[model samples]
Target chain A: MSLLWRNVFGQKTGDDSLAGFLGSIPLFAEMKPRDLRQLAALVHPRDYDDKETVFSEGDPGSGLYLIRNGRVKIFTRDSSGHEHEIAVLEAGDFFGETTLVSPAVRTASARTLEKSQLVGFFRADLLDCMEKNPRLALRLLFGLTRAMSERLHLADRELKRLHHALHELQAEGQD
Target chain B: MAESNGLTRGHVLLFFLVMTASIASGLAIFSSASRITELLHTATTGIVLPVLLALVLSFLLEPLVRLFERGPLTRTASIFLVFALVASGLYLAFSWLSPHWAEMWFSLRTDLPRYLGRGIALLKEAQARVQEIFPYIGGFDLPSRGRVLAERLFSHILAQTTGSALKIGGLMVLVPLFTFFFLRDGQKIVRASVGLVPNRYYEMAHDLAWLISRQLSQFVRGRITEAAIVGLVVGVGLSVTDIRYAPLLALFAGITNLVPYIGPIVGMIPGILIAMVDLGIGAQFWWIVVVYLLIAQVIVDNFILIPILISHVSNLHPLWVIIAIIMGGKLYGVLGMIIGVPVASILKIVIIEIRYYRQTFALPLGEFDS
Candidate 1:
């Protein structure tokens, strides 16, 4: 009875579309239908208070957090506690994986700029489940890898922009 | 700012790894060095483990610390509150186990003798069988080098084990005691560690260090929480089944399982043997043993332990797991074996971060295929 509601539940209308969209994700393309269903159960849509931290950059992190609605910012804080924006995460975006892959502190903090909703999947929990369902695990692995790769791609772009801005500022100062 | 000297994150990481390896390899290969040097890898980990665990525990309990930090309670009182919680948990755990273990001991005193006799008879019969098959092995007479080897190995093991236990008891006071100080002055430590960085990448490295520290702490916190839950579940299950030594068996299972991969099996052996002894011989006993272990495994693996663990420690590879155990075992023996996997995972992350630093700094250009 405790698990009755959980075992055979259906997502609300918008939530169903979100699940559908996740299925369409190249990262999750490998996940089987049943496995996806299992994952869908855990992917609760959660809202954050504005300026509320989803996770801090230096805080211990596990699982990947995906923006389901609204926006979150990834920013790293210096030792002096100065925050630096790393990326703006919107619907369909994910973060917090660098910690999962490397066991390092998050490189940046994730704060809700607007009222935000995110769905999360902890790596440890999912992997354990994956053992029983390797096909789904493989799909998740693909998704995790892609998720990480996407963040790095974004960080790289940011770094390039910083470099260009620095050069421009240097030229301007000389003039 | 001029025509620049750029260090890529790749270059930084390579230099860091190569340098660290060079130092480590030197120490590992040093023949004339103290036996202590051989344990440096493990001994170093012993120090890091307490500090890291303390930091993580502090972080997880930050809300409580912050709550008390704002309250009428003094810093010392707040710390005492934390320690009291830990102490009570330990006390309650021990209290529950004491009676169960007493029962086990009483039963063990009676039953172990029979099991040993059975084992001895089996060994003697096997020896006789081997005598018929291979004369030389049997020819090695009574009180030969075998006894000496066994005796020496056992005595050495006993001495080392006792020494390690004593050392652990003596020093584990530092873990919670330091944890209290860490929770209180953690910011000071972070500031100091950050201060050591130079003007160049000072900001970046500080961010990274804090992040790294946070990640490691979360992993430990999550593991501890998950382990406790598993232990509680196991204890309840055993109690429900009317199994003997439920507390002791669950305690062992819970604590041993703090170590990944190797722990469950390690914890199970003692419990299985205890169960075997408790049953006092019969097919029914064996069936109970099989079922308890099976159900316990299912609940712990499927529902609890693995799910939580994999979520936190997805960074560690199987190769690293084995290597860490071996390396830890070689150094501090069992403790090293226990702490080695998580430490290795953390270190692996550090290595990757160093690599990330190199690429960011333009320290050197190398293939990214790795």
Candidate 2:
């Protein structure tokens, strides 16, 4: 509660806290404090209890959520209703960014692994900020595109490996 | 800290502060009532009205500006080019119509009393005819209020010409200046305003803004087209029938069409009166003008114009449109009535969007939907 601790540790629950947190994110690491402050104003802080569903698969995509603390489970449900964990995301990581580029249904469900805090930056707010500060918007957009491209490349490798495995299983069956 | 019923001393203090602030504001408002009203009036006439008129003009002219910009001209150059074209077009129109307008003006000024006398005499003759048919209806006790209203209506239309012209002239000078800035910075201003929405309802707010902007702009475009077509139709019809001041009546028809429901009736009045005057009561030409206007109103305005142009833009119910016009007229007179439908449409979209979001999203009472 002391000002000294708040200032020195950057643990304040406000613009300064948000700026410090955002500064560590790969996308916003180079952003000026002033610009980050503007971004901070647009972020909505949400608290989640352990095992709470952050979002369900097939739900309409909203925006990206940056994990301020704790962890999240990204998983998918198969036809038989078994959940497959895609990834476990920790603090400083973000998810559900496809909504920023376009309105899309969530491909995976997200749930909190423990008590957590998150900061959401909605698509609409991002677009609005872009109009006001085109340069900053472009930088954020570039970061998003690069992140998505990397994700696609990883997905492509996994898909090809699965295809090879399937062909090999078929050849064994034929022999 | 002290607490009563979960209220802390801090909460009590804040409540009292708010109450004090409210009381102070009320007292201040009451004390400066006259000054506030004067300021409001000045602001409305000087800034709001001119800006609104300029916005409407820009809506009508922006397409032309865009078209010119495609012809290897910068946006500024294109805007200026369109302005120059508009100025020359207005000059040509003025030159062409001046003699007729002057003749009509001369007749109006010199023969207004005579015209009123004739109009009254014609009304009396109709009254006598009705009395003859029903002998129980004796000498008419015409209500003083009705007579005053009739006098006011005519005086307002004919006598206030110069005063209204001066006001319009002032507005004309101011409108272009505001419109230029609006055209140049409209998108940035819009984005800035949209950015003010809270994070929870951010997407909904943006969608609502987009919906309203699209609908309103479409409404404006449709209205301009409707007005031009209606004006041309009325003008050509009147000219064919050899009606006096055909062009002027057509212009009136076009301008008044900006207001929904009541406009066509208002547009038809001067033409009807002129017909009654120029051709004696019960004359053939008078009947022809009446029939022609009826056809135009039915075939043109209601059927063709509304359906093809305006119906899709707002989709405002006729009852709501009427209510909006009445409320708007009461608040802001002519301008309010003209803008009422679009404003109402915007409000409808906002309300609907909010309702939808409330139902779909997890909305706690008194807080934004998430």
Top candidate (DockQ):
2
Task: Give the per-residue lDDT of model 1 (tens digit) for B269-334.
Answer: 655555554555566456545544665566666576667655533467667788889998896677
* lDDT tens digits by residue: candidate 1, A1-175: 7477656784544346666756655567667665567567534345566766665544444556777778988877687867788789788777765555444545666778887777665544454445434556666777778867877899999999999999999999999
Query: Ten consecutive residues with minimal summed lDDT in candidate 1 chain A?
Result: A124-133
Tens digit per residue, CA lDDT, model 2, A113-149: 9999887777766765565557668777877888889
Q: DockQ for all models, in order?
A: 0.02, 0.08
Q: DockQ for candidate 1, please give it.
A: 0.02
CA lDDT, candidate 2, residue B355: 69
TM-score of chain A of each: 0.70, 0.80
Show model 1 residue runs off by greater than 4 Å: A1-175, B1-63, B70-77, B88-169, B240-244, B277-293, B312-315, B352-370
How much lDDT does each candidate structure score?
Answer: 0.65, 0.74
Worst 10 residues of 2 chain B by lDDT: B361-370
